[model samples]
Target: MENNMFCFQCEQTLGGKGCTRHGICGKSPEVAGLQDLLIHMLRGVGFYGQKALEKGRKIDQDTNKFVIDAIFSTLTNVNFDPERFVQYIEKAAEIKAYMKELAGEIDGVIPAAAEYTPPMTREEMLKEAKKFGVMADTSLNEDIRSLRELLTYGMKGMGAYGHHAHILGRMDDTVSHFFYKGLAATIDNSLSVDDLVKLNMEFGQVNFKCMELLDRANTETYGHPVPTEVLITKKKGPFIVVSGHDLKDLKQLLEQTEGKGINIYTHGEMLPTHAYPELKKYPHLVGNFGGAWQDQQKEFDGLPGAILMTTNCLQKPRDSYKDRIFTSSIVGFPDTAHIKEIDGIKDFSPIIEKALELGGWQEDEEDQKILVGFGHNTVLGVADKVIDAVKSGAIRHFFLIGGCDGAKPGRNYYTEFAEKAPEDTIILTLACGKFRFNKKEFGTIGELPRLLDMGQCNDAYSAIKVAVALSEAFECSVNELPLSLILSWYEQKAVCILLTLLSLGIKNIHLGPSLPAFVSPNVLQVLVDNFNITPISNVEADMSAILEAAATA
Candidate 1:
């Protein structure tokens, strides 16, 4: 290991160990330490926020903003600038201190912000900083360990989404407190696996609320997403491809370039934006660009247009088109065009000008098209057909092949799972994980595509909506339906999504490529007993087990 700071909070860590020297991400130890400190401060704010809400003191927008910023600031590939990140930490500290002061005032015990500067070393903080009571360390058995880590990673992703929605004026203290309290819990050593299992479900429960808040924030601002086919072609003129997981940033780009000739194409998690009624209304919005996040270096090399990243899943850009990349919100690159917020609006003029300067493909080319828009609304709209298909054996099985992406070779399991899916089976995918097999044509049963890409990871809300709708149509519980959730997790967003599924009592979810670093054995048993959660095996074997179980059930 290189003699510098190292942190591996993401799935693609160096050599499956904590990244040292520099990350595959090109992030240095200094920035990694700052990111860790930022998370610590956010936890403090979340903890303090919980106390304030408990005392009947309402959390103001500033408190909410600080919390959200703190969470998002730590996301993968977002903020690599230590100076700016520390500014966010200091800002968060100030907000947390103010909230503490307010809480004290409410209780008639006036106090000052914790007048303490963090000891200026990563080793010290990692060693002695107060641990959140909720972490499930590596002391447990493998199965439980996996789930605990799974939940924590998902919370991290959910925190990012929650923070973004907060910026849009959407507030959910119930959800916010969960992060603080949950992180605090993960650090508890005495808690049994059963305790962790229950807490894991709560993470999902709150995540569901968070996703709903985001859904409402988005649909209300944009419109309830409708089923619209997105074109996946490179236009004959100048354009820009916007990727990552932020819809607000996408919307801002749409607003900023309303009449400009530059067309906007969705990439990665942004692919589902086409389903949004408001965003799709723009004719300038083209189609999806390349595949998943992991494929960007190849897909983006010497691209004909500029790229705008709103959030995570950014790999190091190759020199071929590195300069064309622009980042906003928490997404940052060393020298990429940073679209700063000006008067509450993100000005994307630089990217737009760049797009025009470098005109896209010279001639309009015929690009292959794949069907999207199979989100919750679209899926539920065809609920009757799906039910009939299930009953009639047109669609024999339903596989929810959703989760995160990773560099592990074992991830081929997802591809094999999707590929080996029975012709009559339906695959519902979300997040960047779907990229493994989404490119293959699965054909459709009538108008429904066999492979339905649910929006982003947060759009797991769509999967739940479809499941519940199907259940209602069949007059059965979700677990009683012929659905199997085979999840691939890599980060915190997946945690929140898994929690949402568990909170709904959906069971028999098969998770992979590996379990989380948290989770105790007792907790694993609790989840297995209650939800029947299990780790994934070979695709064929897992498929056989699922099909056999469905046949017997």
Candidate 2:
């Protein structure tokens, strides 16, 4: 069959290859094409932005924010509306024009992507989009193409972190400038494989800073995450279930819904919000609702309360609850209610009214709670105990089994690996992947629970911090420590996190359920040779091998 659109940026792409027709996340070919076009225009912006930077011109904060949000919207399952992408393409053209004017008298050659004008009409834009997708430049070598896509996807993830940070009033010029440079590199034919590899690593380093910036923004704005127990059961009242990874949006909603007789519950990535002191202070901020984002359609169907999606990981809403679902902050879907920010504040009163209309659950269910808020501050606050446990062999091994979760078959490896881990091991988890075995009772090793739930995926910074601290105390490199990262990746955010790990010279990361299709065999070999990156084989074999390696080391 002829290909309609090509995208392999996510782990759950069709057949573990490209999504040639429609996205597995319910995005149509038309929407995918428009997203491709939008990315192309953003590259044009980046190209000019780079030239401006070389001329000692500072790119304004507005352009930086626009680029961040635009790139973030192209992430898998973030925005699937074709019209919204068209709007973004138009804005990108405007920004590219502004950047081009700001960057005059360029010295070097300009690529076609830097100077092309976008088509005016939607049909023409869609037609134009087909020429700029993943397979657009077939003349490049397969390995180079793979590396470029890898870098582009990494930047997409960086943009996501940058967007969240920007939302919280945090800005970093170095991080913003790297976005332009990295995006430009994807189209720079003069860059060699080595140059691209170095750029990828540099981008990874910068992304680590970006993640740190986001961590600071979250903690400073909401206060450091404490070890708080979050109730997961339903309560009898009008309620709103907030999903995705935006704490600011959830905070605003909590403020808006205060005393309005609507309780707020978190879903997916937002479950960690309950750990924040500023957010958890709200009396009506009750608990978490569902598990990960992949199960939202079934989880939200016929639900009593309204649902708010603050960021990505949005699937196509089912008809049963589409009317009650709302999108905000760069997440969009056709025909769904979107809460737009007016005067720098999002009015979630629509969602509030919808919740009141629905009347929520009829009766309070039995209370069930899950523990969260084990961020760097929380974990490191008790570092002496953790160090003592390690020294005494009370904690024999440390397993960081976390990343993006998906519906693919092999993801069961993460659950089994966590379940079968020896009693002496400490499992550190983050992101929605924790939903796999979070509810399982893993008894404590001393005072700390065996399964430590570090905040969200971006909170991987927390895990890194703890690892570096442990390595410091043990007088060894992070790799030399008895730690293993068996991660499950589903999207670009996970890609950037993995890059951060590889850039830190951290080794022997077991990533699955499948490797990214965009990673050509040659590029994959580079990763394996340099970082000892391995694909997860089976729960038993991988676990045994990891334990044996730790034991011998």
Model number with the top lDDT: 2
Flag regions of model 2 displaced more than 4 Å.
1-3
TM-score of each: 0.88, 0.99
> Number of clashes in model 2?
0
Give the per-residue lDDT of model 1 (tens digit) for 160-222. 878768767788778766765665454344566667767777778888888888878877887
What are the per-residue Cα lDDT tens digits for candidate 2 across 1-553?
A: 1349999999999998899877898889988888888889988888999999999998899999999999999998888777898899999999999999999988879988999899999999988988999998778799999999999999899989999999889999999999899888888999999999999999889999999999999999989999999898889989999998999899889888888999999999998889999999998999998899999999999998899999988999999999999999899999989999987799888999999999999999999988998999999999999999988989999999999999988888898999999999999999999999998999999889999999799999999999999999999999999999999999999999988999999999999999999999999999999999999999889888988988888
Off-target runs (Cα >4 Å) in candidate 1 are 1-8, 14-17, 20-25, 105-116, 119-152, 183-197, 519-526
Q: Which 10-residue span in candidate 1 carries the lowest summed lDDT?
A: 128-137
Judge candidate 2 at residue 72 and give its lDDT: 94
